[model samples]
Target: MTELLKLSGVHTHIGRYHILQGIDLVVPQGQTTMLLGRNGAGKTTTLRTIMGLWQASKGEISLAGMRIESRATPDIARLGVGYVPESMAVFSDLTVKENLVLAARDGPLDDAQLDWIFGFFPALRRFWLSRAGSLSGGQKQMLSIARAIIEPRKLLLIDEPTKGLAPAIVMALIECLKEIKRKGATILLVEQNFFAARELGDNVLVMDNGTIVHRGEMAALAADVPLQERLLGLSLEAHQ
Candidate 1:
């Protein structure tokens, strides 16, 4: 597989804290790669750094073989990168329709694409005119993800998408992501839900104390309970 996104010796600093320390990873083209770890493991920081939300203190970040470590956030987004932040940063004052419209950076929302999005997240359709702040937490999460896929992107950086969602909605999100993967969208997902990770991830990277501790095939980690416990502190079976 071709490498869509690559990071070599990447490091990030927020004030006096050194968050990411000599990180190295690769996200292959047309595959879902899961970043899993305990809280404060620098998973979110990795996603943010890739999107240029936080500038890398050292090393390099390349997208589609182009150097992008020094690019601005908007420039990175314009380079076919879509980011779904863990905070569910929707336009609180705007209606659902307005939020989606803003997310369609290229131009007006495509009716066909909107229909497809609605199929996965029916709540967005129901509250098309409702204020984003008025929606529930899970609904906001759905909207956040929907905004990222509102238009086709080369790579998607999603952070803990199923954190506050219901089981049924979680399954729906899994299927939605599966369809995206089928359409050849490369995804770098940070998820705590091991079941969703096992279902959607082709490869997995485990982080610890701001560094990658393990990297391998998701199936291999899932089948090995001891390895899962050692790296993630819990087995996939136990988490599920």
Candidate 2:
């Protein structure tokens, strides 16, 4: 598979503290790569760094063989990189329609695209005119994902999408992501839910102390309970 995104010896700093330390990573075209780590392990920092919200102090970041480490956030987004942060960053004062409208960066929302998105998240359609802050947590999460994919993007960086969602919503999200992958959008997902990770991830990278501690196929990690324990400090089944 062709490499769509790559990071070589990347390092990031916030204030005087080092967040990422000489990290090397890769995401292949049309594949989902799971980033797993405990809290405060720099998983969010990695995604933010890739999105140019936090500049890398050292090393390199490339997308489609184009150097982007020094690019601004808007420039990176213009290169077809969509990001859905863990915070579910929705416009609290805006209606659902307004939110989606803003996310359609290229032009007006396409009818077919809206229909496809509604198929996965019917709530967004139902609450189209409702204020984003008035929606439930699950609904807001759905909207967050909807915004990232409102337009066709080459790659998506999603952080803990299933963090607080219910089981049915999580399953819906998994199916939606599978369809996105089927349509050739590469994804780098940070997820704590082992079930979703096992279902969606082609490969897995475990991070610890701001560095990759393990990298391999998702199936290999799922099948080996002891290895899962060693790397994640818990059984995959426990998270499921």
Candidate 3:
């Protein structure tokens, strides 16, 4: 598979605390690479580091073979790297339409694009005129993802896209992600939801205590219940 992003010996420091110790990984083009680990294992930090939201204190990060660790956040974004933060990061005061309008960079919102997004997330269309703050958690998550894909993107760094949503919403997200994947978008996802990961990920990278502890095909990890317990202390059956 072709590589879209790579991190070599990447390290990050948050104040006095050392985070993301020596992260080395490759995100393949047109596939989803799931980043999974227990809480506080530096999953979020890794995404932040890749986005240039937090500069790597050491090592190199490249997107499509060009160095980008020192690039500004917006610069990295404009280079086709879209980020859907765990926090969702929607403008609470803005209407759904307004939020999407801001995410489109080149010109007026394309009707076809809006129709495509609405197909993936009909709630976004229903709440088009509503303030984002008034939407439910699931709706807001949908909106966050829709904003990231408002324009064409090459690589997407998504953090916990299924967090705190109902089973129905999770299923919808799963379908939406599958559609995104079918369109050949490269995705680096951080998810605790193993069920979702198993369905969407082609490759998997497992982290522990600020370092990658495992790397393999998602099917290999998902099928090995013993390995899941050892790596994540999680029961694959429970997640199912």
Candidate 4:
């Protein structure tokens, strides 16, 4: 598979505190890769570093074989990366349609793209007239993802789409993501829900202390109870 992004021995510091410690990973073109680990294990930090939100202190970050470690966030984003943070970054005052319109300003919302998104997230179509703040947690998540689709992106770094959401809503979001994957988007998903990650991911990277400790096919990790307990501090069977 062609490598879309590669991080080699990357390190990041926030003020005096070192966050990413020799992080290394590869995101292959057109695949869904999940980053998994316990809290404070640096999954989010890795994604942020890849997006150039924080400059790496050491090593190289390459996007399609081009060095991007020195680039600014906007410049890096312009290179075809989109980020959907865990906070769901929706404009509270704007209506759902308004938020999507803002995201669609750079280019017209292509009929095919709009049709695809609306099909994946029919709920978004229903709430188009509602203020973003008025939507439920799940509905806001739908809006957040829909906005990302408005921008033409080659790589998407998504953070915890299932966090704090109800089970039914989480399932719906997962199906939407599956549809996104089907449409040829490469996704680096940061998620805490082991079951959901196992279901949606093609590949898995386990991080601890800001570095990748293990990586392999998703089913391999899913079947390893001991590994899950050691890294994630939970039993996979229970999550299932």
Worst 10 residues of 4 by lDDT: 231-240
lDDT string, candidate 3, 93-112, tens digits: 99999999999887789999
In lDDT terms, how accurate is model 2? 0.95
Q: Give a tens-digit lDDT track for model 1, residues 82-102.
A: 999999989999999999999
C-alpha local distance difference test of each model? 0.94, 0.95, 0.92, 0.86
Candidate 4 structure quality by residue, lDDT tens digits, 1-240 = 999989999999989989899988999988899998878998888888888888899999999999999999889878888889898989989998888888775766677777778876788888878899999887888889888877677899999988888888778778877877777888999887766888899999989888888999988889888988887788655554
What root-mean-square deviation over C-alphas does model 1 reach?
0.9
TM-scores, all candidates, are 0.98, 0.99, 0.97, 0.93
RMSD of 3: 1.0
Off by over 4 Å in 4: 237-240
- Clash list (residue pairs), candidate 4: none
**Alpha-carbon runs more than 4 Å astray in model 3:** none
Using lDDT as the measure, the top candidate is 2
In model 4, what is the error at residue 76, expressed in angstroms? 1.8
**Least well predicted 10-residue stretch by lDDT in candidate 2:** 231-240
